[model samples]
Target chain A: MTRAFNFSAGPAALPAEVLQQAAEEMLDWHGAGMGVMEMSHRGREFMSILAQAQADLRELLAVPDNYRILFMQGGALAENAIIPMNLLGQRPDERRTADYVVTGAWSVKSQKEARRYCDVNIAASTEADKFTRLPAQAEWRLSKDPAYVHVCTNETIHGVEYFWTPDLAAAGLPDVPLVADVSSHILSRPLDVSRFGVIYGGAQKNIGPSGLTLVIVRDDLLDRSLPVCPTAFHWKTVAENDSMYNTPPTYAIYIAGLVFQWLKRRGGLAAMEAQNKAKAELLYGYLDNSGFYRTAVAKDCRSRMNVPFFLHDETLNDVFLAGARERGLLQLKGHKSVGGMRASIYNAMPLEGVTALVDYLREFERSHG
Target chain B: MTRAFNFSAGPAALPAEVLQQAAEEMLDWHGAGMGVMEMSHRGREFMSILAQAQADLRELLAVPDNYRILFMQGGALAENAIIPMNLLGQRPDERRTADYVVTGAWSVKSQKEARRYCDVNIAASTEADKFTRLPAQAEWRLSKDPAYVHVCTNETIHGVEYFWTPDLAAAGLPDVPLVADVSSHILSRPLDVSRFGVIYGGAQKNIGPSGLTLVIVRDDLLDRSLPVCPTAFHWKTVAENDSMYNTPPTYAIYIAGLVFQWLKRRGGLAAMEAQNKAKAELLYGYLDNSGFYRTAVAKDCRSRMNVPFFLHDETLNDVFLAGARERGLLQLKGHKSVGGMRASIYNAMPLEGVTALVDYLREFERSHG
Candidate 1:
């Protein structure tokens, strides 16, 4: 069977070229006589792999000099506790609150896990309107002297995204920093790295694989972790050692590095953003114009990566999915929590994949509606 | 170049056949269009991969019914902090102590990391002897009713191992649990699974790769976690969800499953133990008889996996390493902390590789002498 365009929200589609390159090097990596997986993290070969990966990621993202990119294990779900354990120490006694904006499901999980570490202050929430729109920055009621503000820049399940970083200084917490969970939509657009103190995500989505988590943290944010923070997760220790405090996920990093190289070959993030936006527009534009299919989220807040739409007659959902699967339009079923259809066209998904999905959307509506 | 004999302490040598098989399946796994990395962790394709890996590992290790196997991220280094965090809650107020035996660089790190989470009682340490000997059970001062006793059963750095589990009842700490860090030599030999409360290690050494850490812990040890323990690291949650509390390292687990199948085909751990012992003896026997070479540890306590040997003429160390490398022996240099040479003939290292290494040792000595 030929490769299909995978629409999984996470552990999502990766470029086919990267997979081929990985297969070519699976036995002997660049004449080193050992696969990347078998090379010791401390060895010269894997060291080069790690160094090149870090450099390429920094260049592609145009990441600021003050930021450190760490290749760590455990996904963003684990980082939920790690973020609080690491950042709350800045407040000294863990007495000051960490403000959270609950835009969707991902942000809700982040805040709930944080409560175990410190006092959580709900700065704002849009659940009143069913998380259909990203709450306006003006509606936020931030806590007095908070440690840090948390937000999920893009929600994987609910399909809402904050396309712009909120200006925390203007929002009254001048000294406070914004930490974002950018799991689903990291490389799909241009990000002003200076705006957020920290940006983290599991690599399963736009990155490479499930094991590796990318944490891009500001230099000032280091060395302030609570004493109870695990040494493996201590950002200061990991940053100081260059993410080598422990044995890193070498193969995952290797594959991710290949993906980074691929992204660079395709003209880096700017070009990728253009392609991703065009793909999302093709799908969303049709949904908006189509009478039988409707998107749940507001037009202003619909995620460019994960676009979930409902069929007017929901009973035909199975028939629609079967047809999509048969045509190699794979994993188009929406999350069980939000039942309908979601086409997650991440950075690796070409423009034609979305167009094919759109074609299927109209064809299925014609037959059933 | 063909695959060389990789003598790395970790991220060590893998069976060549396993690497070849992984390469073959790298693009499409069993007709699934997407590679293992791009599949949804919740999808059926990855779920089968995860389940098979767990089942194969359990069968090979003969894991007891009372135990739960957790596939986690973060190597053994992370577990140093995680073990205390997951276990300290059993003490309720973090007042009760955990006993640790500092045998080498690895165990020293385990205890130091545990201090951040709980009271650590160093039962015994061999630093005075310069890590040349393991502390005898009689010399260990068992803490009065400690939470659990921690030991590195196989220390990768200093080349030491406990061939048998220490009897807590005979040592007067009856009914206390034991946690063994078997990172370097897990599948190199057979084990009595019922003898320990938890057996955990990074997969880099003998198991598979660098990302996945296998934790086989007793069922009763679950659910007792400190309030601040990350949900992803919590044993009960991971055990309950079948290590899916967070997305497990999917690709690493897949490769590990393949290694387990390889190990099983070689007649499980017993056959591996026989082969491993022969390989160790073949190298150690040559070192013992050679006037130019010498081993540091006591004969009875010598590791069957990591064989660290020193050249009698220390000036010829660089010459020996260069000569060995020219003959396709790789990463044979000892840890920088203990500079000489270490040959780790793990499960995947056939007896012939050890024979070749011994031949190289003699060839280098003949010229240098």
Candidate 2:
């Protein structure tokens, strides 16, 4: 009955209400005599669930009419290759190249994967600064007639985030479409759907669970898939079929729908963003004051969702994690590459969880400082 | 809760016991303080779940040590292209061709998708027979030096099941590996894993849910992926990473693992096969004896998992489904392409459910005939 404040990034925490509702409907969904997982993807009952989920997501994000939202699989990692395959085909006669703004680990992986499908150009990179901040849009080297400009708006591993949408026109790349991997911080705030050509993220972070990926692409971009793109992964085929070209992760979608409903009940993204900001401030504010812990990411571009911080005394890292777990504060261990502690406070994580984490951080520091 | 006998073709019924257990552990799995869906893929808790699921599946199927079981997404449709991409590069100097035995709708789609990556040869096809029967192995005309020979052992749409494995050696294609999409009937019976180089299926029918695809591939064949293969879909990388190269559909995998445990508790595949046989006999026996209903699939090849039948008077089709639903029998409507009724009695469908279905069939016939 005692749930921990789970902070593991991606496949992280989900709303308690969503899980409770799911548990109640596990055997029979809405008296349909079968659980959501057991129902046919094409059945009337599941169709309703699918429709509601899609509609809820659209309303929550205020998705433009010209955009198509696709519930896909293979996570954001698969989309690295899939994105280029879908975009590079738009201009077959032109040079097959795409621009990537590498902020951290995810964008690094994204650009490398796209290299297999097209010539990847790192137009902007914060890797030189150890991915501590987002690269300024003014400093980005524009590519002439590139297929698309890719960016990881939120880097889960490095705890860096883009506070503002990169305007291609401002960067002298007006014609180039901006594609963003917004996996970690998608629903943590309100987004201008019209600002990007395509926005995609795995559902495990701010959404529901892993396995279900949400891709929101402008309708015009749907027809630009390469011949080599798998039929199931092809945006046009999936969009045309209403994401039913393949049997989508039904239960995942249902859970995500439940999450969307929960979000709406909590006053949608604007309210959520406000709470997220408060939670991030509570933790970051404490970290900034404490000499025992130090957050490396720049203040302006620090991810409100994922906060990776290091112990001032590195030797106490193990002790810090062990004590946190004892207090039911879990998954605070940082990514192996980063070698520090990370707290991913996604949409599902309540302020209470953050307060508890901060309390534990202070307690650990009081003893170890 | 008045649970019905759900007969969805895929995304089909799951064991009630598994569903109940999942519900019980929804918010807190094994006192870990977070559900399986909330756990990090690399965390000890979820890793144990992944390991156990893989081990249980390996044990249930008696998969050989040389085989690596991969948990993937994108369903069977995506695997259609992934298969060719992963297999075609074994012989770069030779013609890129793969032989397919198209017996039904799934295999037809499978072969068509493979055409995107390599030359797909229809080695054997029962399309002339309306996929009512499996084409005999002796009749196969496989290509010379094909990367692999593929087959849909059980066609969910056509209700044609292969009672025996196809021996490549007997067909004079000894070295050519055999790949079978056993999606709809995978766990309904004992499988000889050694017979196929790769055995994959969407974990919807005879498994757990939609979204998770299981690929059991022999280790030697894992390294044959083409350069164009997405890293996430590359079987070699997937196998080496233990299917953790991407954030897998964790919750779906957890559910599938629970079903695997349920299967073992139900005395493994041998016991499941016996019950499945009995249930199939009850329904098929009724269909054969009744003049009002007819199953078109060849008697020897009729699937024990999916029984597709038609009303003698086509006008009464709607009435049949309505009555069946009223009697707590659901999803009896056949695929639109086939235009009839299909009762997909997977491993989860008990004999009592089939008996009730038969009772309804008798009542409907007496009332409408």
Give TM-scores of the second chain, every candidate: 0.98, 0.98
Q: Which stretches of candidate 1 lie over 4 Å from their true place?
A: none
lDDT of 2 by residue, B33-63 (tens): 9999999999999999999999999999999
C-alpha lDDT of residue B58 in model 2? 90
Tens digits of per-residue lDDT for model 2 on A181-239? 99999989999989999999999998988999999999889988888999999999999
**Of the candidates shown, which would achieve the greatest TM-score relative to the real structure?**
2
Q: What is the TM-score of chain A in candidate 2?
A: 0.99
Docking class of 2: high
- Residue B135 lDDT in candidate 2: 79
For candidate 1, the TM-score of chain A alone versus the native chain A is 0.98
In the order shown, the candidates' DockQ scores are: 0.84, 0.86
